[model samples]
Target: MKFSDIIGHEEVRNEFDGLIKIGKISHAHIICGEDGSGKSFIARELAAKILGKTEIKDYADLIEWKINSGKKSISVDQVRSIIEEVNKKPYEGDKKVIIIHDADYITIQGQNALLKTIEEPPRGVFILLLCETMGRLLDTIRSRCQLHKIKKLPKEEMLAFINRKYGVLEDKEIKSILAFSVGVPGKVEDFMENTALKSIRDEVMDTLVSIKNMDYDNIVKCAQKLTEYKELWREVIECFAVYVRDSLIYKETGKEELIINSDKLEDVKKLAMQFSMNRLNRIFDILNFAKSNMESNVSVELTYGTMLFKIQEV
Candidate 1:
C-alpha cells in the first residue's frame, strides 16, 4: 500500500519519504508500536517505495521472518537463516528488504545471533524490525538501527478510515468499533470481520450500561453469561475499559467530540452522572485486577463474578 493510504503518522511518512528520496535510508531500521498497530504494514509500504515496486508480495528480493506456528519466539536457528541469506545479493534488484515481524519476540540468544548482520549487513541489504516493544532488544541492537515509533492516529484520521472502508455499517456499530479500535487500523479489521467479537462488544456495552442498576441475581447471571465468551475476555475487558474511559472523559470535558463512544453520547452522559471520579478510579482498579487475574489463569467465572460485585459496590 502507498504511504498516503496509511491512516496517520504524517510526520513519520514524510521523514521516511525524504530519507528514501535522498538515498540516505538506514540499512537497518526498527519500527516500534503497540500490537496490531500496523508497524509491519508501514514498513512494507516503505520497502515497496525503496524497491520501486507497488507491492512486496511474491517478490524475490523481499524476505519475511516471523514466529512460526507452535513457536513461542524466534529461535537462534531462524535468526541464523536470515543472517546467512542477507549475505546473498538481491535477487531482482540492487536492494533487498528483510522484514522481521514480531521482532519483540526474538529471544535474547536470537538477537545476539543476528546482531552482526543487523549491525553491518552486506551492501544493498536493509532490515526492518517490527515489534510491539523494544524492551527485549539489546542496547547494541537498539543503537545500530534507526528507530521509528508508531503512535495512535488522530481521531479524524481514524474516523475517515472507517467511514471510507465501512460506510455500509450502521453509525452506532462504526462508532463502537472506532472506540474499541482506539486509532489502531489493524484492529479495526479484526472487529469488523469477527461476528463473535462484535457480539462480545455488544454484551460488554450492555453490561456496563445496566450494571449499576442490576439486582444481585442479574449481576451474577450476567457474569456467568460472560464466561461463555472466555476466549474473548481481552476484548470484553477492553470494551469495558474504553466505555468507562469515555464516561470519565465525558464527565470531565462535557464534550461529546472528545469521547470515543460518541455514538453513545446520551448513555455515556448518564454513565458519567452515576459515578464520581473516585468511583471511576475504583472501577479502573477492578478492571486492572480482573485483567491481572485473567492473565494469571485465575478462574474466569470467579474473576468475572468478583469484578461485577466490586463494580457494584463502587
Candidate 2:
C-alpha cells in the first residue's frame, strides 16, 4: 500500500523519508508493533516507497521472506538461502530490500545464522524485519537495527478514519466499532472481515447479561461453552471488559457520549440498574484477574468459571 494511504505515525514516515533522501539508510531495520496495529502494512509501505513501486508486490530487488506454509517457525535453511541471494547484486533497483515477515517466529538457530548479515550487509542493501514481539529477537540483533514502531491511533484519528471509510454505518454501529477497536485502525477492518469475531462478541455480551441470574448449573454450562472457544478467550474477555466498562461509565456520568457501547445502550442501562457501583467495579477486577491468569497459561475453563462465579457473587 502507498504511504499516503497510511494514517498516523507521520513522524516515522518523515524520518524514513529523510533517511532515504540523504542516502543515510540503515542496513538493518525493525518494524515492531502489536497485532492489528499495522506493523506489516508500514513495513511494506516503506518497502514500496524505497523500491519506487505504487503497489506491494514482488519486485526483482525486493525479496519477501515469510514462514513456509504449515511451518511453525522460519528455518535456518531459509535464512541461509535468503542471505546467499542478498549477497548477489540487486537485479533491478539500485538497492536490495529484504522484507522478513513474522520475524519473531524465526528459530533461534535461524536468527543466529542471519545475525552476521544484519550486522554488516553489502553496500546498497536494506533489511526490514517485521515482528509483533521484539523480545523474540536476540539483543545483539535488535541493538544493531534502526527500530520503527507502528503505534495505535488516537481516538480522534480512529473516529475520523471510520467516518471516511464507513460513514454509511449508523451512529450506534460506529460507536460500537470505535469502542471495540480501541484505537487500532487495522483491527477495525479485521472485525469486519471476520464475521465470526462479531458472533463471539454478541455471545459474550449475552452470556454476561444473563450471568447474574444464572443458577449454579447454568453457570457451569456457560463456562463450559466458553471453553469451546479455546483460541478466542482473549477476544471474549475483551468484549466483556468493553461492555462492562461502558456500563460503569454510563451509570456514573449518565452521559451517553462518554460510553462506547451506544448500540447496546438498553442493555448497558439494564446492567447499571441491576448492579451496584461496587459490584460493577468488582466485575472489572474479576475480568482483569481472568485475563492475567489466561495470559499466564492458566486453564481456560478455570479462569472463565472463576470470573463468572466472582461476578455473580459481587
Query: By summed lDDT, which 10 consecutive residues of candidate 1 come out lowest?
Result: 1-10
- Residue pairs in clash, model 1: none
List the candidates' TM-scores in order: 0.88, 0.82
Segments in model 2 whose C-alpha atoms lie over 4 Å from true places: 53-56, 163-167, 244-256, 265-303, 310-314
Which tens-of-lDDT digit does each residue in 151-200 have in candidate 2?
Answer: 77888888777877777787767776776788788779877777767777
Q: Candidate 2 at 139: error in angstroms?
A: 2.0
Best by lDDT: 1
RMSD to true structure for each model, in Å:
2.5, 3.4
In model 2, the clashing pairs are none
Model 2, residue 308: C-alpha shift (Å): 3.0
